[model samples]
Target: MPSTPSLNDLRQQQQLAFLAQKTELRIGHAHACPLPPEHLAELDEHASEVTAVLESGLTARVFQLKLAGADYALKKARPNCLVQNLDGQTSFLNELQRRAEIDALRQRHGGFSGIVPTLYGSLAQGIILSPWLSGGTLQDWDERKLIQLFASGAELCRHGLFEWDFCPGNLIDDGRQLWLFDFGYMYRFDPLTQFNSAGQGNDVPEHHLAERIETRAYFAWLLEQEQTRGQDSALAAFRLEKEIAIEAYRKLRLELGADGANGDVLGWLDGLGQQWRQALRGDGEALYWQEGWRSHRLDLDDDIRGQTCTPRTLARCDWMLNALQGNFDALRSSGALAHETIRPERGALLDHYRRLRSQAEDFQIA
Candidate 1:
């Protein structure tokens, strides 16, 4: 039998492939990069350009280069992704398709911070060229900016782009616009349509095209399902938190376009704050993480049982609930929730957040 190549062997092979490239790469960018010249002949000529390394995650070397008055981002596959039929062909096709989907977004030109990358094409050198988007990610943004960041993130999810790794890292802001970068794990799909049809497609929809990313119920099902039984508690908890934030985020997005919803992120969070009301509806213990959840709260001493909330806090919670309800009603109403900016309510929303903190403390004691 042929000896199975070890991981070390694969790494060695990959290094060899990387070294074979003649272009002198520029260093200290995002990751190790060799910007593809627009013409292969040009790359052949200036094979001695300064070396550049990108502080990014291209799975392969990606470099930024300006050729013929236009900027382009280039990525080359490592040896591991180029073996025989295992990871080679499939990963290549996946990335090509992913790039194609991203390029398709050029037609919409939506004002999303994480706007999809513009994929130019791939080459024989195992390089893929995309439009360079220079920007900071969500991790680099502040709280106020985060709301817009979340809005843009939701914008992608709402648009049917299932770039599930749509976190701050993959998102960039080069001052003018925010752009979503690195799409290896992202796929496209229509959740309602896919779930309704039993999900048998070769290609997933882009993140910008999905009707909904996820919600509170999404977590409920996952936590209750046996398939995810062995999943780590931290991961599961994070997923739950993400779902809650996503739910509120979706509502905030619609508010950008003059929808009736208040776009109260905190209000949407209220549903997440109290799982009791939801768990009360069915087999209570099935999905409720009462213990893990209690431990996850802000404090343990505060108790909110039967205590009337301060007017501001109560109003905030009510607004959030209303925002969620409004979004659902809108989605089910006209077959889609219109895309718009997410304008949040300020003072009341702040009060609501504080109250949630208080209630969260109460939640811990429960």
Candidate 2:
């Protein structure tokens, strides 16, 4: 009997073939896309149509184009992705795959409200084209934005897709609705049998929709809120987010249960919902501290591992160090360090994180 190939194995095989130019990567929704594959492939030749060039993306460059009086965003994969890891190397291909799945999901389920519509994606051509979103990245988060973001996350979860990266760079708000446009880090899993796409799925229950949102996007923004406004203001914002998350998880629990999801999966959702409910009923200060610690820690680790550390990563490091110095007892009492296999003493933990902070500074991406 043969064993199943690991995700890394599959990714390596795909990357090799893709780099060797042996794989033909072409995908599109005919009803959604106005241009044909041949035209999309030759987009760079029509430089006169380009309105703007955005080179800030790590894995791709985006061109704002005007064709026949209509605007479009054409994303071209960078010859060398800046992320510098296996996942980064194959992200463009992964995105094309997820886009196809998302398009199929939309066809079957009508549409996903918060998700951006994909026009077409071709890995071999190194381009993806979609209608231009006039909206800008989210700067200030409000109840409407929080509700919509979580609702979209829950909807994706119910459909067996787990999006890992919800950073500000990937989110947009047009004053009406939030939109998720990046699928580079999104992965598929069995919602009926797993907690997420990590490990065996249920093994890493801590990494869920809400956790991913908080770790990747919310906490960094919250860190800014804390520094600019104050601790009280940051806490208030976090409370609002939690309130929205509680409702989202509650609905997700009911929906997944109806779909006959695993007992452990449903139980996990119920536990999170109940926990948030209890915290909201009280002051929620302890809950806030615990979750904040977890989110910052996880996000910091992610940035470091990906070698994509930014100034925000350093800010998160400072947050953890401050928490350790001033609120170590609170962290312990809240069970924030319970996830650590070997309990770290205060001094050791501080030194450990300080070294990580140094590494973050060294690896700061341009």
Candidate 3:
């Protein structure tokens, strides 16, 4: 009988598998991209003239390169991922895989209008180049921006690609369009019978497109508004987004149903539509409070675990403490703080948040 592999041996085997798979990715270039052969050959010669270093973390080094009288974004993968985990280690390879699939899909389907155009890439060399996005990250979520985002997400979902991250950094609004340039966290899911790209179709109802944006992006934005504007301003913004989400979901459901969607998927969408419709009629405020708490806490835990804490993390903690102080009973009744072990008194909860905030201050991401 063969001996069982140790944990270290298994890890090594996984690493080898990852490397082999990454090596198999085919290099693809857009026909319209302007870079010539000489520019590709002289990447090293002009390396010192990098216009900007977008990111210098454990995953990859992103540089804004100006060559051939044109600007481009170059991403070079690092040998060791900064994330220090399995997913982190394989993120670059995962991105390459998604890019290849998406690029192919763009050729067959109408096209991914919201995705950044890739120029050239080599998976073996761990490098990808794309046209430089001449836009800034979204500062505020307006109606137009929300529509573009939701439409892009819905389009990807219809094609069986589920994006899991909507963080501020991964998205850019080029005035006329919102562009998604990262695919490290996007995964495949069955559109006909699944709710998202995780587990079974109905296993995780909370992981939908709207929920993802709410949990990962909007809640933090709301926290910031609660300070600069006020609680009423934040709540108003949440309500507006929810209204937009409701319409987006309705359209998605109609399209999926017409496309011979599975009964399970249809039923799931129906349930979501009904819930949002009812919430909009009367229970919207309650829903906002419940989802607001959930989004903040979930996002906070993610940042803390990844050691990428930001000012928003501290702001979220502050919001939590304030909610506990003024509306503890309502929050508790709504199951927002259902998992707490400590007493729900103001002092205890305040201490807890303060400790978390202090720890987060030490781990701010660069």
Best by TM-score: 2
Q: Best by lDDT, which number?
A: 2
How accurate locally is residue 117 in candidate 1, as Cα lDDT from 0 to 100?
A: 51
* Model 3 lDDT per residue over 229-288, tens place: 998888788878888888888898888888888888888878887877787788466777
For candidate 2, write residues 1-366 as lDDT tens digits: 987665446656867687688586667754555567667657673478888887768888888888788998888888888887888888888888888888889989875899887787877788888888887887889999999999999998899889999999888899999999888888778999999887667777888988999998898888899889998999999999998898899899999999999899989999998899998898888898889999999998888988999999999999999999999999989888877544556888898899999999998998
Worst 10 residues of 3 by lDDT: 37-46
Better of 1 and 2 by lDDT: 2
TM-score of each: 0.42, 0.93, 0.85
Worst 10 residues of 1 by lDDT: 294-303
**CA lDDT of each candidate?**
0.41, 0.86, 0.76
> Which residue pairs collide in model 3, if any?
58-82, 194-201
* Candidate 1 Cα RMSD (Å): 18.3
Total clashes, candidate 3?
2
For every candidate, C-alpha RMSD to the true structure in Å: 18.3, 2.5, 4.5
Query: Which pairs of residues collide in model 2?
Result: none
